[model samples]
Target chain A: MSKQIKGREIHLKSRPQGEPTPGNFELVEVTVPEPAEGQLLVRNLFMSVDPYMRGRMNDVKSYVPPFKLGEALDGGAVGQVVRSRAPGFQEGDFVTSSGGWREYHVADARQYMKVDPNVGSLSAYLGVLGMPGMTAYVGLLDLGKPVAGETVFVSGAAGAVGGLVGQIAKIQGCRVVGSAGSPEKVKHLREDLGFDDAFNYKDGPVADALARTCPEGIDVYFDNVGGEHLEASIGKMKNYGRIVLCGAISQYNATAPTPGPRNLTLAVGKRLTLQGFIVSDQRHQHRRPDFLRDVGGWLREKKVKEVETVVEGLDKAPEAFIGLLRGHNTGKMVVKLASGPA
Target chain B: MSKQIKGREIHLKSRPQGEPTPGNFELVEVTVPEPAEGQLLVRNLFMSVDPYMRGRMNDVKSYVPPFKLGEALDGGAVGQVVRSRAPGFQEGDFVTSSGGWREYHVADARQYMKVDPNVGSLSAYLGVLGMPGMTAYVGLLDLGKPVAGETVFVSGAAGAVGGLVGQIAKIQGCRVVGSAGSPEKVKHLREDLGFDDAFNYKDGPVADALARTCPEGIDVYFDNVGGEHLEASIGKMKNYGRIVLCGAISQYNATAPTPGPRNLTLAVGKRLTLQGFIVSDQRHQHRRPDFLRDVGGWLREKKVKEVETVVEGLDKAPEAFIGLLRGHNTGKMVVKLASGPA
Candidate 1:
C-alpha cells in the first residue's frame, strides 16, 4: 500500500469535428493506483487504435458510450499483472482488458482475460488473436457463410481483419479477390495473402476493377470500406450473394452524411443478403470457442499471418489513430505502451 | 386445328425512358389458334398487374427476362379451358397461368394450374389467392420472420403484396403498422386490414410519421415502396431487426439510379439483416403448401379479406399496370378480361 509509481495516460482533449487531429488527444502523467481487494494492477504493454473509435468521438448515443472530454479513452490493451489482491491471479500473469490508451490500470481481476504468451506475441492479442481477428472470423464464417467454390471479395484487404478474411476464404476453397487504396497493398494481397486477384481502387473506377477481377460475380462481399466500394460490390454480386457489413472505415471521418450505394435496389432482383453485426453481442459469445479453435489452429499451421504497425509510446496514440483513419497502416495499428518481460 | 377466333393482345412497342406511357403498349387483334396435342386453348377471365412487371419492361438483365419488342407481354392470368387436347385439362376447367395481357392463349397444359373457384373469386386468383398473395406470405414469414408481439412495419401497405403483408403480420400476433399514399388507403389499412397504426406518407415526412407511429421501434420491416419509406424504416428499426425487400415500386421507373438509405450504416451497430427475393425462386417452391394452407384458411375464416381495384377489358391492362406504379390502386390491382360462368 505504501509503494507508489507514476504512469503516462492518453485522454480525450476535445471531440473532433470530423477528421481527428493529434490535438484532440492529451498525454498526462498520473499515479498508478494500488490494487484493491478483488482487483489487480496491470502494466499495459500495448494499446490498439481502431476505426470504430471515431464513431464514439461523437456525442450521439451508440452501442458504446461516447468518449468523455478530458477523460481517458479506453479500448483493447494487453498487459502483465504487477500486483494482485484477488484470487486466481499472480504477478507477471499476461492478460487483455478494455483499459487501453494508458501505460497502467487497476481494476477488478474479472474485467481481464488471461492470454497465452506462448501462443502469440503480446501485441498479437490486440490484433490478430483479438477483437479484429474475431471480427473477421465470425463475420465471414457465421454471417457471410461463404461456401467452397464461391467467389469472396473483400475491401481494405491489407488491413488486419480483411487480410485474415481473404486467407480464411482461400482455406475454405473459394476464389478470393480484394481491393485496397494503394498498389503496394494490392500487391501484398496477391503475393503475401494469396488472394486470387487484387486491385488498387484509387487507380480507376471500383466497378471496372471488380468487373475485371471478379468476372464470375461476387458470391460474398466483406465490406471494410463502404460508399463506393459497397455500391460496386452490390452491382457485381451474384444471385443470393451475402454482404457482411463489418466496417465502413471510408465514411467514419466524413463531415457530412455519406450517401449509400445507389444500386442497393438490386438486392431484390439478385436476392442478396446483407447483415450487420457487433462482435460483443450476446448471441456471438457461443461462437467464441469456434473462433479460438479455428483461428488458433490457422496461426499454428502458418495458414494465417499476423501483420501490425506499431507506434513507440502512449503519447503518440492520437497520431497512430489519426493515421489509421488515413489508411496509413498496412494492418492493425497499435501503440506500444511499455516493454513486456524480456 | 382449323377453328379460329379473334382476340386482342398487348405488345411492348418500345422501352420507356422513365415512367411508362400508354404509347409504349400496342393493342393488336390476333387469331387464336386451336389447341395442339398436349395443349389447351384458354379464354382469360382476369389478368394481374404487379410492380415487379415494371423491371421487365426495361431492356436489362433481371430475375425474369426483359419483354422483347413487338411480342405480347405475359404475366399471371386466370382463365377457363375453352378447348383441350391434353389429358389433364378439360374444357370449361378454370386455371391460372403466365399468359396475361391477352384475351386468349394456347399453351401446353403443364404451364397452367387448375384453381378451385370456391376458394375465392376468379380475379382473386390474380390477386389474393395468387402470386401477390404468395409473395406476401413467403416474404414476411420466411424472410422477415416477425415473432409474435414484435412490431412489424410495412411500406406500400395499400398495394397488392404490402396489404397482405400487414394482415399476415396481424395474424402472426404482431403489432402491425403501415404506410400508404392516400387518406383512404390509410383508413382501410387501420380499419379493414386491422393494422395497429397507419399513416399517409404523402401527408408528412416519413421519418416523423414513423417516429410517431412506431414509438418502440420496428422489429421487422416489409419494404415494397423503397426510396424514402425504406430510409425511414431503417432509421426506426430496433436492434437485430429483419428487413424483407419485396419490391421497390418507388424507384422501378427511375431513369437514374436511386440512392439507398443513408442510415444503412446503422445496421452494423444494430445488427440488422436485409434480404431480397423473387417469388418464383426454386427455393420457395417447397413453401407453397404452407402458404396455401395458412392464407387459404385465413380467407375461408374471413380473417383476411380480399380487396381489389378492377380495370375492365384486356385493352386496359397497360393502363392498369401504369396506374399500379403510380400508387393509384389500393389492395390488389387486376384487369378483368371477360366474365366467368354464372
Candidate 2:
C-alpha cells in the first residue's frame, strides 16, 4: 500500500508595479515529493518576511536573482525534517532552510543546517538570531565602527535589524538615537531596546527630529529607510562620519528609481564614508562565529532582547509580507505554519 | 626717507550668485606691509586657481572656512622672499604659501614651506610636486585604491588632479579612462597623459560615452566634476567599485542644489563604496613624504609630464578663475605675477 501527502505553497501570481497587493500572491496545493538519496523532506514551522525580499519580487538584475512569475517564493524558514535519506540529517530534526512560504519541501541535506532548539525559540532562528541579527551585527559593528561616546543614529529603529543596531551601539558604550514609523515603535525603541532617544518620523521632519534629538551630530548612521532618512543623516553627520547602507525600505515599492540624497556633496566637506553591503558577502561567513559567540552571549546574558510578530497559517503569509512593507510589524515578521514534526 | 612700495591684489567685490563675472572682482593697490618677527615679505611669481576655491566663495561652513567678502582670496602660491625677519629663510629663497591673487604679500615663516628650486621648475611646485600632485596621489592611492589591472575612470581628466590621477593609475598598471569638457582636452588626456581612453563630455551623452569607453565597467572613479559625471560613473561602476570624491566643479556655481544620481540604490546591490575627502586632512601631513618621494621620482624620471596654462598678470586672475570654471584650460591654471628670483 502507498500513501501521498499534499502540501500547500505560495507562488508569485504577478509582478508588482508599485505597492504589492493580495492578488500578487497565490496559494496552491501540490503533492509532496518523497525524499531522494542525500535529500530530506521538511515540514516548515516558520518562514521569514523581510524588506529585501521586495527587491527579489521585481524582475531586475541584482546580487540575488529575481523571483519568476508563478514560481514558489524562497526565503529563510525553520522546519522539522519529517523524512530523510541523507547522512547527518534524520527524522524529527529541526533545521533552517531556504524553502520558505511552503508547508513542505524536499531539500538536499547540505542545503539546510540543523538548528538546536535548546538555544532559543524556533521563530527567533528566523529573526533575531538569524539573518536580521547578523545584518545588525555586521552593519553596525563591522561597518559603522561606533566608538565609545560617539553618537549613533539608526533609521527604521523598531524593525528587525534596526532594533538590534541600537542595542548593539548602546552595548558599545555609545549614544544611540533612532527613528521609527509609529509612536509605539518609537516608545519600544527607547524603553524596551534601551535607545538613548527615539522619534516617530511620521510626526515631523526627519532633519528637524535628528537635529532636536542629536544636538552634537551623528558620528555613525545606520541607514535602513534611505531617501529622506539618508538626506537627514548626511545633513546631521559630523566630520569623518560613517554611513552603513543596510537597506532602503522607503523606496522599495517605487515604480521608478528614486533620487538620491541631494546633500551628498556634504560627504566631501565632512569626509564621510558611505559603504553599501549585503549580508551574503563572504565576510559574513567568516564573521558568523564571532557574531554567534558575542551576540549569543549577549542574548543569554539578557543584555539584548528579541521580538517577533508572528502570523499563523501559510495563507496569512502574503498578508504578513504586505503588512511588513507597510510597517505594520513591531519587529521581525514571521509566518507560522500549521503543522510540523512536533 | 623711504618710499613705500605699493602691492597690487585682487579682492572679491561681490559674492557670486551663480556663475562668477568680472564685476565680482576688484583689483586694488595697497602699501606693502613690513615683515614683523617670524614673518617674511614675498614677491609672488605664480598662483593656482583651482575648482575647490569656488566652494569657499559661498557663505557656508565647510571643511575650510568660507572666503571673507571683499578680501583677497588665498590659495597655493609660489614666491621669492624679498625680505625676511624669520629664521630658516633668506632673501631670494623660492617658497610656497597660501598667498594668492596678489603681486606681493607678507606671510609668517611657519605658514610657508621653502621649496628647493633645483628639484623642479618653480611652477612645478604649484602643479606636479604641490597640492594638485598630492591630491592625485592620496585620493587615488589611499581612497580610490585602484588595484593593478583595474579600470579607473577620471572626470575633468585634463585638469590639475585628474591628469595626474590617470598617469599614476597607469604607473600602477591600470587601464585608465577619462572624460573632459572639450575635444582638445580629451586629446591632451589620451595623447599627452597616455590615458587608455578619453571622451569629450560636451560631444554627447555622458552615459553613452562611458558605456563606450568603460566596456568592463569602472572599477575606480575619481570624481572631479559632479552632477552628470558622477551619475554616469555610478551607472557604470563594477561590484565593489570605489568612488573618490575629490572635487565637484559642476555644482560649485549653482544657486540651488541640483539633483543627485538617480540610481544610488545600485550601490547596495553592487556593494560599492563612495568616500569623500579633502587633501588638508592630517593623513596628508603623514603621507606627504611618501607622495614627495614617489611622485618626485616619477617627475624626475620624465615618466610623467607636467602642463600649466599660465594667464599672465594679476589683473587676469579673475578671468583665469572664470575660464577655469568654463573648462578652458588644458591642465593646471596659474596666474603669473612675474619672473621669479632667477
Candidate 3:
C-alpha cells in the first residue's frame, strides 16, 4: 500500500558551468518507498537548501562526491517517521536525515537522527541547531582561535554560517565586524545579529572598509567569500594573525578562474596563518553533546539570535538554492514541506 | 693609527631589472675607523650570500629594508675582533655580526655574537648555525608540522635553506625528496644530503616528477621557488597537507605581476594550509638556543655535514651575491675577506 503512494522528487538533469539554470533540474513523481528491514519511512517536513550543494553539481573531485546526472539531489532534511521497521525508532517520531529534495524518503534507522520538537522549531534543526551552526562553532572557535579583545571579521555575514560565526565571536569577547552584499543584509547584521560593525561590500572597496572599521587591525578573519574577501582580509591582518577559510561563495559562480590577491606576500611579513578547514575535520567530535547544550542555553538566554528565510514548498527548492548563491536570502534558507504539527 | 689603514668596500651602483651586472656594483676604498664606546673594530673573515638578499635589492616593501644605491651592501658575516671598547668582548675573538661587504667594519658590540672555536668552523655559524639553519628548523617543524612516516618535499635543494630543511625532515623520520636545477645538485641532494629521492627540475614537468616520486602523496612541502614548484606540490599534496612558503626565488626578478596557479581551488578541496613565514617571526624565541644546542651536537656527532662556496675577496661579494641569485653556488655561499690563522 505504501509503495503505491506517489512522492514528488527533483533530479539533476545537467551539470552547471557557472550559475545553475532551472533546466538543470527535473521534477517528477515517483513511487513512495516502503519501510524495509531495519528502515524507516519518513514524511519530510522541511528540506534544507545550502551553499555546499553547489559543489556536488560539478564533476571535479572534492571532499564530497559530485551529484550524478539523473540521480536525486540530496541534503539535510527534517521529517517524521510515519512507519518504522527498526527497534530504535517508532511511528510519529520526528527525525532528520541526508534526505533527497522530495516530499518523502526511506532510509536505514542509523541514518536518521531523532529530532526533539520540544527543544525548538523543526526548521531550527536544519539550520542553527544542525550542520551550519556546527560549522560556525567549530570553524571560528577551534580553527580561527579568536582571543579576548581581538577584532574578528566575518564575510557573508547574512548567511547561515557567517551569522552564527559573528555572534559566537562576540560571545567570546571579540569586537566583531561583518560584510554582506546589500544594505538590508548589512542592516540585519548590525541591528539584529549584534555585530559591532557591518558594511556593504558591494558599495566600496572591502579593504578600505576593513581598514576603517578595524583601526587596530584584524586578529582573526573568518572568510566565507574567498576571492576578494581573502585579498582584503590579508591586507588588514595584524602581525601573527589567523585566517579561517571556511567557504568561498564569491568564487562558486565565477565563469573564469578566480584571480586571488596578488599581495599574498603580506602573509610572511604579518606572520599570518591562513588555514582552509571543513567542519568535519574538527577534533572534538564527542564534544557535540556539550556544544548543543551550551548553544541551546545561549539561544534561550537571548545571547545568540537565530535568523532564517523559509520558502513555502519543496517545488521551490531549486529556486531557493539559486537565490542563496546570488545572496538573495537573509539567513539560513529552508524549504517548508508540511504546514504545522508532524 | 686605525684611520691610516684602507678598507675595501662594495657599494650598490644601481638596481638591476633582471640579472645584476658588474656595472651595478662599485668597488671603493675607505679609511678604517677606530672603535668608539660600546663598539668593536673587526677584520672580516666570511660573509654569507643568501637568496633573501635578492629581495633587498628591489624597491618594494618587504620584511627588511631595500638596498639603497651608492650605499655599501650589508649581510651576515663572521669576523675576528681587532679592537674593542665594550665589556665582555675583546681583541682576537672570533664573532659574527651584520658586517657589510668590506674588509674592515666598526660594529656595536651588542650587534655581535661571540663564536666558539670548538664548534667546528666559524663559517658554519654563517650557514647552519645562522639564519638559514634557523629558518629550516622552525619553518619545517613548527609550520609544516611534518609527522614521522610522512613524505616531505623541498624545492631549491642545493641552496642553504632547502638543503637544511630536507635533512631536518629526514631526522624527524620523514621520507624526504628534493628538486634542484642541475644534475650535480641532484647528486649532492641524494648522496650528501641523504634525501630519499632527488630530481633535476629543469629536465621535465615538475608535476609529473612529483607524482612519480611521491606515490603516497606529500604531507609537508617546504617551498623556496613558488611559481611552478608550488603548483606542482599542490597537485601531489595529500588531504590536510601543510605548505611552508619560505621564499619565492622564481618571482623576485619578475617584471610583471606573476600569474598564480589555475588549480588554486584545490586548496579548499584538500583542506590544505599554505602559510608564509619569515623565521624572525617564529613564536618560539628559544629556537636560537635549541638550534645551537641541537645542530652543534649534530655537527660533533657527524650526523650532518655542510658545504660552502668561499669566494676570495670583499671585492667579489657583489658578484657572488649576483651568482647566488642565478643559482651559481651549491650549499652555502660565503666570501672570505681575510686570511685565516693557517
**Comparing 1 and 2 by lDDT, which wins?**
1
TM-score of chain A of each: 0.98, 0.98, 0.97
Interface RMSD of each: 0.7, 0.8, 1.9
In Å, residue A62's CA in model 3 sits off its true spot by 1.7
Query: On residues B1-342, what C-alpha lDDT tens digit does candidate 1 reach at each position?
Result: 466799999999999889999999999999888788899989999999988888898999999999999999999999999988999888899999999999999899899999998988888888878999999999999999989999999999998888899999999999999999999999999999999999999998999999999999999999998899988888899999999998888898899989788888988988999999998989999998888788889999999989999999988888899998999999899999999621
lDDT of 2 by residue, B1-342 (tens): 134768899998888999999998999998888888899898999998998888888888989998888888889899999888999999998999999888887978999899987767888888978999999999999999999999999998999899999999999999999999888888888889999999999899899999999988999999998898988899999999999988888998989878888888888888899999989888677999998899888889987888889999999999999999999888789989989642
Alpha carbon lDDT of residue A62, candidate 2? 90
Segments in model 1 whose C-alpha atoms lie over 4 Å from true places = none
Is model 1 an incorrect, acceptable, medium or high docking prediction? high
**Model 3 vs. true fold: TM:** 0.94
Quality of model 3 by C-alpha lDDT: 0.86
**Candidate 3 lDDT by residue in tens digits, A1-342:** 443667888899999889998889888888887778999888899999888899899987889999989978999999998889999898889998999598889888999999888766888888778888888888798888999899999999999999999999999999999999999999999999999999999988998999899988899999898877888888899888888878889888777877766666667667788777776665647657866887788888888887899998877889988999999988899999885333
**In model 2, which runs have C-alpha deviations exceeding 4 angstroms?**
A1-3, B1-3
Question: How much is B57 displaced in model 1, in angstroms?
Answer: 1.0
Would you list the clashing residue pairs of candidate 3?
none
Report DockQ per prediction, comma-separated.
Answer: 0.89, 0.84, 0.55
Best by lDDT: 1
Error of 1 at A92 (Å): 0.6
